[model samples]
Target: MSIIAVVTALALSIIPTGDTPTVSVQQGAVQGVQAEGVAAFKGIPYAAPPVGPLRWRPPQPVQPWSETRAADHVGAICIQPPANGDNAVGPGPMSEDCLTLNVFAPEGATEPLPVMFWVHGGGYVNGSGTADLYDGSNLARHGVVVVTINYRLGRHGFFDHPALAAERPAEEPAGNYGVMDMIAALKWVHANIGRFGGDASDVTIFGESAGGVAVSQLMLAPDARGLFAKAIIQSGVPQGATSRLDIATPSGPPLADRGASFAALKGVPADGTAEALRAIPAEAFLDPAPNFGGGDLVIADGRIVPTSIEDGFARGLQAPVPLIIGTNSNEFPWARADTHPMAQALTPEERTALIAAYDDADDFQGRFISDVMFNGPARWLARQHAARGHPVYLYSFDAWPDAMPQPHRGAWHAQERQYVFDTLSTSPWPTTARDEAVAKVASDYWATFARTGVPAAAGQPAWPALAEGHEEALVFHNDGVAVEAVPNAARLDLIAALLDRLKAAGLR
Candidate 1:
């Protein structure tokens, strides 16, 4: 067939054939099969190869192809240290040429659908948009266009150097080249989503864990201001960024600090530390300590971040968009347990030290960790956003089937995230019926929000916002979804106040 005929046929296949349909795009095309009436396009490249000199630099626009590019298999993941256990290959030998994205769109999509750009979470050090748990297929079938992207990771994505900066003085960025890559993807979306039948206006950006933190940063970024409209942050970070002191903001304490800023990364050799960072292989830069944490996340790099995110938000500098945010019931539990070198059952003495931190009379050590990590921080932020009168919807995914074994990772961090993206098969959870049920419910709620800003799903219990102190908020409980007074409200409040006092005293 001629190129025009091939392109025309591909585009036509994307249209509905009564109940059957598909769609095509440039570079390649997708003839999507309908799942509840939505079409999904998988694994599309958004930028030029990050290989060669582009490895540590900001992403550049994708090279346009003469023929439609086929997007069937997932692109290779951004370099990420592999999962520590069973899956540990330490990001399994990555390439500098990894800048790909996936898309999901409504079937027979002619009009511009609302766009929901998602950034995945791997503590800014690990994770890929291709993790079976993040398939945007089912999500696109829900009447929106979902785009998940890959950016540089660890040293390959976030490295800093003085030579490169001096070389690109007209385009010098402080670091956080990964975050900048995300912004570039959004800009690409804004420029090209129309061709994919996606609406540029009324975009809703959302993510969990590190991805949520990325969304939070996007909200604070002056450069990212007009790129999105609404945002959903599932267990996002409002604070606790490391080595950001190295960033040189136009104002404020440069995002960089100590000897680790992008400037420091740049100054490593010039400042005489180059022998250490450069002498080592790039992959060696992945220290095990941050253990998928943001110790190496976006820095203050004087450019994109401009200043501390909290300071920026405090100064009313964040994008004023509707925000839907929440956390699972067991974030802190796994954070402590997983990051440790030795996974030992806590001894009585160890347990006491753990529970003592919370001043709790109960023996649930898990609760203490959970409280400190997510519950404490999440409740405070919900209230703060509520005070600002931003439409904030808070939820707690406390439900896990009783059948899942002991030392249960009930609704743990990144656990609910799989469900939200409708990628249950990607997870190794015990495949009990309860797991399936929870996954469906969670996916439904997520899709509902992507469809409408509110996370209301039918046949489930009514989920109220944390807006009023009067109305109960949604709780995904063992008893199925319920509306509660923000689970353990009093304890959460105490933790919040305690942290506040400690912060005021320069202690926390």
Candidate 2:
């Protein structure tokens, strides 16, 4: 049955039947569900499944469906490690045919609203857009369209090999299938979001952690230009995060070399064909021993990611759009108290200066790791973007919830997500009155940013944009929001200086 024929038949069958929202996209018509004043479309295939012969190739167009496909529930999540009681991939079963996205919009929308596209983070190895914590229904109620998408994960998403390269067109991308999936999804949204009352020209791409890293890469990607007008990166881009496609770097060997090693481990010859590599069962790659997609997930593949993020920013090559980049107060708890790797990079005098600045060795160790890995890099990126005369906002989230276990020191990585999405009700931790209040403010700020390019929440401190020398950040604490100097600036500056030295010497 052809799509035209299906549409003709559907019109005869009382198409759009009552209040169910049905949208016609390039592929075909899709019927969605409505709830709580929000119309949601889930499991909408933006591209064909990357299975069988299409295993590693860039996303291909989905075959046109002949009928109004039901998009009531999310599609299967991409293959990943089993969740340890954290349903990271949502309720859907795991499979390779997981390139689907969901959209949440006000059911009574009368005009095109700003679009907020969300990318999920899981170390580039796991996670899906279907997770309950990521539901955009509540966020959509704030006068914007919200979208969440699932890209390929693990080896299925980011693998490279000579055979795969040999078989592909010279211009096609390799080793960054996940990145390609994101671009494809964005293109789909640009073409189809208007049907859901979303302004395609006002799309703001945002994400947390690896998703945030993806947003940064997208800003650096030439293919991703003009696809979005704004970006928000949360705890992404630890300094020196990029890798090479075919050469060794201080971070790791070429991704192709790793792929060849994995192929050899799976009993394929070093010169194996792409067919043999794709023949290996997807589940076989899930074994923890091989670490198929581990290490340096983003690669400078020349076509997609042309250069390292820092270098791109330094060279003024990043997308000249509004930016919001930040990190958590305690991204990682440092266990080693006696010695820290950062100290090795410093001289005796520098170490003495750091010790004098921060008295407690154990506390310094933990904050040092967080600063070097997350906070410092965020500030540096914010500075670089701001230097380019772009509107840049930097924030540090330290909102510890009451439901958190005893001795709650500070907000941990990704904790701001619940507040950002106003989804505290989904948390296993009991939601307190203060938590709900913070969530309202947090979501308001995010949604407002998507609408106006400025983050403003009612009854909260106005979030300020970063300037060349003014290194201020909006602080989200347990009590409420406040504008303050970036915490740990002195330590972060020292670490940044050491990291610069290491990068110059190619030793980081």
Model 2 scores worst on lDDT over the 10 consecutive residues at 8-17
Q: Which ten residues in a row have the lowest lDDT in candidate 1?
A: 250-259
| TM-score of model 1 (CA atoms) | 0.81
Q: Once model 2 is optimally superposed onto the true structure by TM-score, how far is the C-alpha of residue 203 displaced, in angstroms?
A: 0.3
- List the candidate 1 regions with Cα displacement exceeding 4 Å: 1-38, 84-93, 242-293, 334-364, 401-403
lDDT of 1 by residue, 453-487 (tens): 77777699766766665746677765568777777
Evaluate candidate 2 by giving its C-alpha RMSD to the native, one decimal. Answer: 4.5
Per residue, candidate 2 scores C-alpha lDDT tens digits across 109-222 of 555678999999888888999998989999999999899999998888998888998888887888889999999999999878877777777899999888998898899889
Task: List the candidates' TM-scores in order.
Answer: 0.81, 0.93
Best by TM-score: 2
What global local distance difference test value does model 1 have? 0.64
* lDDT of candidates 1 onward, in order: 0.64, 0.83
